[model samples]
Target: MSEGAKLTVQELDKRFGDGDDAVQALAGTDFSIAENEFVTLVGTSGCGKSTLLSIVAGLEEPTDGSVLVEGHEVEGPGRDRGVVFQAYTLFPWLTARQNVEFALRDEGLTKSDVRQRADQHLRMVGLERFASARPNELSGGMRQRVAIARALSYRPLILLMDEPFGALDALTRQLMQELLTGIWEQHRLTVLFVTHDVEEAIYISDRVLVMTNRPGRIKAEVPVDLSRPRSPEMLSDATFLEPKAQVLEAIREESLEALE
Candidate 1:
């Protein structure tokens, strides 16, 4: 592992079933995430992105190899890593603030402490005004923000997001991306986000990790050298378009070959 790497995965492999029924989701996958850095993983569907995240989150154990966080082996899910999924995952019955408060329940905090902390996170995600609203009453984006607040409330060492904005419409997705980048900059949380959207990957990540089709493994790591605090306008700039084109070409070639 490198000196500043906050997380490391080595020789990781995952398989399901047996013999002819067997399927390999990840084959000797390896990668490292530096502390306070935002890294996004991009690939076609079923490329083991979510599976790899599950391993890192300790939601599932790898059939081979290891996952380490802050140089320590990830034995199981801990408060050190928080996850935001594509689904809102907020309790439908619970209000937005209540949902965030629920995450902090296991931290042995006092009731007052939980409320204070939850309120802070909700405000950070710009959902403070909707604190009393239930998930069903919120828009798709608002619900997602609630989910993000719930994750951030735990004050985890890293935030692992699996296409949290994938379910939103185009305009909503754009807004959410900007919101996320702003939050990331403000909090400096180490993030490992999984997305199939190449444009989204390029727009928000410090570095983009491209993976092979199935039995996925890291194919390439492309750093986005554009200036920070990237806006939607940057997408039309030559510097940004060049890297985006390169990544798109790589994905296009891979997809075409997969069809062959």
Candidate 2:
């Protein structure tokens, strides 16, 4: 696993089934993410956003094209990448510390080392105090935090997030956004995040890639010219809204075309 890994996707394509039943999920998709860069992909529902993400995670193979992480073509799932989903997949029977520890125990760490690592990440997510609480006892946001801590426990090269905040309420979603950005910066982790909310995409990403409706392809790249250390204040300012409108318009046009 290379630190602050770079990703390259070229002419990516994915198809399912065959003949008349064939469904092309992604077509000629191409993009590059710099090491430590925070990039977000947004599109209409079923536009292959999740499918594309899964390919990058090596959970699925692209029907065409290639994915290279730090110049090496990805073969299959590797320890270099960590994936977090919208649904919190923590174990209800385990305490928060145990949940994170479970992800580390398989990494060859000693029991005491695993405990220390779990402590470190749970503290990073601001849940060290809740270490004894099970997923059943945590709020939706906290559960997601535990999921994040578990994913990072392995210290992977990049974090692949698929709608990780989509399940939270508006207010909690905003808070999680703030927390995630901080964690990303502190860890200096390369992050590829997927989301449907246009505003959220602009607010959190260094660049946003708007995708066309299914058989999805990159439609537009909006560089979020906003300065770093972002805050909710940026949302109401031109720095954020301009790029938000650009990304939103790109998606809107693609979405309309899909319905036609």
Candidate 3:
């Protein structure tokens, strides 16, 4: 692990079932994410992208090897790591502000402190005005933002996102991506975002990890050299287009082999 690297995964492997029914979701996967850097894992379905994120989030233990956060092994879920899933996991009964406040309850914070902090995060995601709204009343994108605000309120060392924008429509997804990138830049968070969208990965990541078909392992690490504060316009720039093509080619080859 290098100095200032927020997270490290070494020879990580995950398996399910046993014997004839055994499945290897991840095999010999290794990577390091630096402090305050944004990285994305992109691959086809069943490539263990979510499984890998789960291991790093300590939601599931790897069958082999280790995951370390800030130099300490990730034993289980901790405040050091906050996770946002594709679904809006907020309590339906709780208002947006209250949902975010719930995450702070175990932190020994006062109600006033929680409210103040939660409001700050809600504002960060442009949802401050919707704080009193329930999940059922909000749009999909709004709910997702609430989920993110809840995660951010914890002030975790790393934000583990599993296709957080995957459920939204094209326009909403694009807007959410822009919102997320702005938040990431403002906070300098170490974000491990898992997405199947190649263009979204290219737009938001400092480096994109391409995973092989399951028994998943990193097949390539493509660094996004395009200068940031990235906009949709950059998608057409050669710097972005070139790497996007490379990733597409990698995915195409994998798809072809899978059919063989």
Candidate 4:
């Protein structure tokens, strides 16, 4: 693990099945995210990107190795880490505000405190007006906002997201990306995001980790050198294009090999 890393994965490995029919999904995967740094993982399909994220989220256990947050090994899901998935995992019966409050149920806060925190986070995500709306009543983007607010309600040290905007249309997805970056800027929490969108990874990440196919491992780490307070216009600028091309080339190589 690197010094002062907020989260660290050391020699991680994961496999499923047994004997001759076994399948290996990851091998010797290692990386670290610094405090308040934004890191994204990109890889070809079925390269175990989600698997790695799951391991860090403590939703799934690794076959070997460990994940440490602030030098403490992660044994299972805890309040220290917040998770947002591609699917909006909000409870159907509850309104948006209630959904966020549900995450704080075990936080041992007063009812008024919980309600205030839920409203505050919903406002943070630009959904204060929709607080009373149920999941079925909200748009795809709105639902995701509620999900993000819920994940953030408890103030986790690390935010783990897996393609949280993947279900939206292109326009909605772009808007969601911008929204996420804005929230990240304001909150300044360590973020480990997994996505298949090369441009999205470049636009939002301080460092992008590219992984190999099948039994995945970090194949390359591409650092985004674009100036912060990133604007949409910068996406087409030379500085952004340079790193974008590098990340794309790395993924293309692994993608091509996966099709072999």
Which candidate's TM-score is highest? 4
Q: How do the predictions measure up, each by TM-score?
A: 0.97, 0.96, 0.98, 0.98
For every candidate structure, what is the RMSD over all alpha carbons to the true structure, in angstroms? 1.0, 2.1, 0.9, 0.8
lDDT of each: 0.91, 0.91, 0.92, 0.94
Residue-level lDDT of model 1, residues 1-260, one tens digit each, is 76779999898999987899999999989999999999999887788899999999999999899998989999999999999999988889999999999999899999999999999999998988999999989999999999898898988999999999999999999999999999988889899999999899999999999888889888888888878787999989887888788778777777887899
- Least accurate stretch of 10 residues (summed lDDT) in model 3? 248-257
Please list the residue runs of candidate 4 whose C-alpha ends up more than 4 Å from where it truly belongs after superposition.
none
- Residue-wise lDDT of candidate 4 within 1-260, one digit each (tens)? 79999999999999998999988999999999999999999999999999999999899999999999999999999899999999999999999999999999999999999999999999999999999999999999999999999999999999999999999999999889889999888879799999999999999999999999979999999999988777799989998999899999998998788778
What tens digits encode model 3's per-residue C-alpha lDDT throughout 56-113? 9888999999999988999998999999999889999999999999999998988899
TM-score of 4: 0.98
Q: Which candidate tops lDDT?
A: 4
lDDT of 3 at 88: 87
Error of 3 at 256 (Å): 1.6
| Candidate 3 collision pairs | none
Worst 10 residues of 1 by lDDT: 245-254
lDDT per residue for candidate 2 within 1-260, as digits (tens), equals 23444998889999999999999999999999998899999999999999999999999999999998998898899878999999998888999999898888669988889999999999999998999999889999999999999999999988999999998999999999999988876767899999998888988899999999889999899999888787898889988889988988898898788778
